[model samples]
Target: MKVIQVMFDTLKRNALNAYEASDIQTPNFDRLQQKTVQFNQFFAGSLPCMPARRDMQTGRYNFLHRGWGPMEPFDDSMPELLKQNGIYTHLVTDHKHYWRDGGATYHPRYSSYELIRGQEGDSWKAKVDKDMNIDGLDNIPDEFKQRKIGSIAQDLYNREHMPKEEDHMLYRTVEAGMEFLRENKDADNWFLQIECFDPHEPFFVPEKYLNMYGVSQEEFNGWLMYSHDDYTSEKADQLKNFYKALVTMCDAYLGKVLDFMDEHNMWEDTMLIVNTDHGLLLGEHDWWGKNIMPVYNEIANIPFFIWYPDLGIQNESRNQLAQNIDVPATILEFFDIEIPEFMKGKSLRKVVESPGEVNHEAILFGYFGSNMNVADQEYIYMRAPMPGKEDYLYEYTLSPMRMNRRFTPEELQGAELDNSFAFTKGVSTLKMQTSDFMGKNYQRFGNKLFNYKEDPAQKSPLTDAEKEFEMIEKLKRLMEENEAPETLYTYYGLDQIHSVEDVRKEHEVLDREQEAVTEEITFVNYHVKDGYLTLINALKDKTKAQAMKQHVQETKAAVTEDDIRNWIKDNVDKEEQARLFYQLDMTLRVD
Candidate 1:
């Protein structure tokens, strides 16, 4: 038995010809529709890049407990499980994230893997081009410069080496995948994952592809930015064309896989699962990218196709509520391996065979710390944190690394041991508080409800009381099933806001107290014994400092503001210490 999973980073569903893509030329996808079971409503369980990949690898949702991070030590990785069952799992391609700090734990799960570099902000293939202005932040987008201010100058540096279409990462990644297939055509008992980080950002493709869509080579920049400061109707149209051209390029390479399958007659036995990590926004719903925005269909409803020889369900589309996590369970079941009890995903065998049977009433999906979204057949509910309730947020993880690096001392300072989640295999995890520190968007958009039947575009939010209640209940039930941390219930206001009256009261309280409620958070080192004197000297009221020093001396304790901060650190919980010291320091400045 064999399975080949072609995973793309941000392949939009609506950009595929099979998924009612009108303007985009995705004939390869259309051909795939004839050879595979096209999933019409497949959604992404976790969001962005690494979180979605974690869901695919672990067969469970990662966003519920943690944001972007490495795979947990206890994660039942799909490829590793397959290998344990006498199945050889091999990974190939240029998804540069697999080598990142957060996604580093995933590629190793496979029996053998090949990593091709130079995608997105991947620091690969350095070449000092004296002709190009490499040092300035002028070329970099503001999202890469300010709020998420950084430089993607590496991408341009990497591009300097790839001068031709064939030299591009996309081309090389697909070619490597095809080479793997060529080598393993006669071999069995192997699962191959060809992951490509293309059709994602910059929409960087060959000029030939752009020419097909009447776009010039110079017209495309990153095309997708997190900010809407430059969005216009004309810009949207231009960006859409660029995106379509890249998707077409993706289709061109995808056809190669189809051609290989057809040439070797591998479709008779081999299973092919073509899926994306998640979809890109492509200026839909007046948004440019996926971050800090609502997880609308453009970003959550991804492209998924499967062709299992035994199922014989080709050339048909299913309305099943499949998600990224389901890919692992489907592959396991195909090889007759038992799906782990820890996995929340169900096999798609029944989804394709059982018509008119709904597999999920509502599936939860979102970026962690952003929105907790629930989508059923009819509507989607995006629940944000209540005004004051957004103050508390945490990420429970065995792996303390963020998307690109290890957690700093400040982030790890307040971490506590938590042993509540059932999926953690009785192992305790570090409970780290975010506490308004992370640059990632949390509760940027308010609560929203969209009925698909009325607003397919999700432009207008609905105001149905009954529907909102039902969706909220379903979200709560799903969250409970997922064994979400108890703090999340409070942070999301699920434990508090039940009715309109509850909402009204919270809003009133928020309105009155929000003006005066400014909380400061930080960590203090007790080794700074002079902190006591520093605090005392900085105080406006010398008499009060003197009185406090005398009291501290009598009690055999420290007297400075820093000393008090350290004292709070040694006595009170770290969570409360920061706030207490902040208040004390604020008071010390008073005359």
Candidate 2:
């Protein structure tokens, strides 16, 4: 029972030929289509990157509980469970987020892991260049508002170390994955994951893959802003070419992976999975990137293909609605492991083998503190928050952090221990406040019901009275089933009484005695780094920079201009430090 899971980041559904985008070339995906069961209605869970990965690993949604953070102490990671059950799991990935503060707890679940660095602002390489001016670059984090088309400072610095096509991280990622399979392909009862961060923003492909989509190399901008733009249609087409070329590169690497499987003659007994976290909008819906817009068909609907050895279904497409959260259950069931009762996802082995078997009646997908979307076989409903609500979202997690760095002390100042979730292992987690609010953006794009069966493009908003009521009921039912926060029920104005029992009454774990920890040990490595990031961003303001530098010097901690992310990983990755900064941090700036 060998399983090889191949994951990609920001892979647009239309970029692959199997998903019926005639323009982009994906011969390897087309090849996989013949050897696997293509799921036409597969959707994404959570969002962006780490949230989706958490959902895939835990077989449950995380967006309702937390925004973005590491796997909790109570999380039931599939790979960890598999490893405990005598199955070996290995991870080889170039997704740089796995090493970040929010994603720090993921890769260790595998028996062993390998990471290929220098992808999308990873703090990998270090050097000082006199002429390395970043004023011309538009993709820096500080310039995200008007970010146009340029690589960030860190990515450019990392690129200096990679002058050849084979030097790229994606190439190295694939090569290392093959190296693993080369050593252990014959071994059974092992799971190998080969994940790549490609075709995402900063679409910096090797020169070989560019200019193949009829857009010349000179016209290719390797970056796209994460906001809506009025770029000329000509520039949009050029950007599309850039993305297509990157996808083609991904396809090429995928073909190499498939070639490895073919050359080894392992398909007869091995299971192959092709999946993505979620799709991105490439010049569609007047948007260029993701995370800030509605989770439309272009983004929520993802491309997934699975090849099961015993039940080999080839060149066939299934319309049953499934989401990425089901991957954990599918893999667990394949290994004959018991799916945890708390796992809400269904095992797709049955769904794939039998056409009449329904995977789910409805599934919810979106980010935390935003519009909650519901998609069934018939309709797609983007449920809006209340019109005048301030969102007032709280992230429930054992570790409080964001995608990259730790949350500020102010954000965690109001945290309270909560035990409302069913899968938290009876551990009360920190219920912290966040600044993610919903108003104009979330509500405006929502309340939109698209009859996907009649209007696949989602251009026309359907106004069916009966279907709207049905979907509203469906949303409430699914939300309650998922153990949604009480605020979420109010956000959608679905706070009607139902048969669901009171949570505190049903689960009285809170009344139990708290575990006591009284040991006190001297900590050696407790130095806090200075506010160098504040210093760097305030360079133009000499007065502010001087004040920040003085404050930093007063703190007497290690300071460096080397890497902000490295500094964060070293300084802010701890909960106590994040909370300490509330009192220690300077209020010299708007902060």
Candidate 3:
């Protein structure tokens, strides 16, 4: 028997809906829908990519540990468990975060792994540009160039906005898997995990797919509106279309792998599971990306499908509140192995045995930076930290660093009625910053109650009733018990023991050197060459050019230009030559 898991990164539910409405047909997913058991109400365990992956791989709630960092040695990851059981586990993915020194531990735990790099957004755009022969074109419209160049530029800057090259990674992975199957087909049972980094962000589909959306680039941006207004309405719409296109593209690639399975007769004994790490936020709650806001259904809810011919469950949809953590337990159950006692998720075998029946009461969701929530099928309760007086005062003065530095009453006057929300303002009075509080003890801030059945979007806040208060208390207890380590506080200087002397000593050197330097040179070198191409494209649009110039000026000011230039010169050991080349490169590229 063999188990195959296909995981897509940041595949949003709305993106799937858009693909269904588009010209392209996702027959592969449709087939899976017909033959496999699908879970309509599946949710992510934790989010912001790596953290969620950690939960899925380890079968443990990440809330019990610190968010997004190295996995502890004690973590009993599923891949390692599978390997111990004589199951050859393989991982194929293109997520660069997993390759980082601190992040790569999880990959090597598997028997065999492949890290497919250079297939991110810019890399995919470069592939598209190279394939389409757009590099030499001088007559391209500024908007089109902006779209093309912006896609690459955004990809270079942000990993989330990178391209959906999961299909490419999948193809290569399937090829490798097929080879492994040919060799190990007659031998031991194996477990293969094919993870795709796709449908994430900076959504850039091939032009051919863009044509299928029946919308211009300008019209497409409207669908991509995030919480921050990072993309204009026009840009958002295009991104939505691109996201849909990538989903369909991924479906097409999945179809190829399924075909290979059929041709090799591998489907007969194999248990295939197709799912995603987490969902993406496509304009839900006025947000575009995943991390900034609360985990709405759009991002938390995911599609889970399992196909096992021997299980006798086929073509069924279950409205079970299954978390990704269940996958490890389910696999263990399938092999007749005992599920670990510490595992929080239950096996899906019961649901598979009774197709339509499920018992899902409540599930927990959390944000590493801010809050935690406990949502049942009916209601959602969110608990977030309230900003104290010092926090409020700092917001008005824009002083994030100097927490102990007090502002005068005049400086704190207008701050009372600043941009804070009504609920936040009300609770702010009861709270105190960690800095102001002498002890490490803290209180839960404000708790939000919502009837999700009536308000799925959570637009209307439910009043704090007796039941709501009880629920909030219960959730608060759970949160305190399941709290991740206080890593953020320690790293951000909030947990430091700073004396007045310590503060003065830290700033004294800087104060003394403030006027010591003059006539400095600064140079900013971008690692990606295409970043320069993007600057060139931005210059063609007068508005964008001005914004670019202002951005450069601000950036230069933020990190002393002279200091940067001198560092570069000293590092390169060719002062005049490096300076001349750097300036000439920027000038030639920026028009």
Badly placed stretches (over 4 Å) of model 3 are 17-24, 121-170, 177-186, 214-226, 355-360, 389-446, 473-591
Over 4 Å off, model 2? 129-151, 215-221, 437-440, 496-591
Candidate 1 vs candidate 2: which has greater lDDT?
1
On residues 206-236, what C-alpha lDDT tens digit does candidate 2 reach at each position? 8888857765444543656444233677877
By lDDT, the best candidate is 1
lDDT of candidates 1 onward, in order:
0.75, 0.75, 0.56
Write down the worst ten-residue block by lDDT for model 2: 513-522
| lDDT (C-alpha) at residue 484 in model 3 | 33
Over the stretch 193-292, how does candidate 3's per-residue lDDT look in tens digits? Answer: 8777765654445445556675543343222323323455776666666776777767877786688777778767888899887887666655566654
For candidate 2, the TM-score is 0.81
Per-residue error for 554 in candidate 1, Å, reads 54
Q: Per lDDT, what order, best first?
A: 1, 2, 3
In candidate 1, residue 292 scores what lDDT? 57
Give the alpha carbon lDDT tens digit for every residue of 1-591 in model 1: 999998778898888768764888988888988998888888999887889888988888998888889999989998999999999988887877788788899989989988887777567865554233333233233333432222355666677688798998889988988988999899989898988888888667788888888887576555365432355787677778888888888889989999999999999889999999888766566556775567888888888888878877889888878788888998999999999889998888888776676778789999888789999988999987654565467788888887788889888997899999889999999998775432223432557889875788887888666677788788989999998888888888889768756655655665454223211212143223223433443444567556545545554332345546545455454444443443343233211
Q: Candidate 1: deviation at residue 345, Å?
A: 0.7
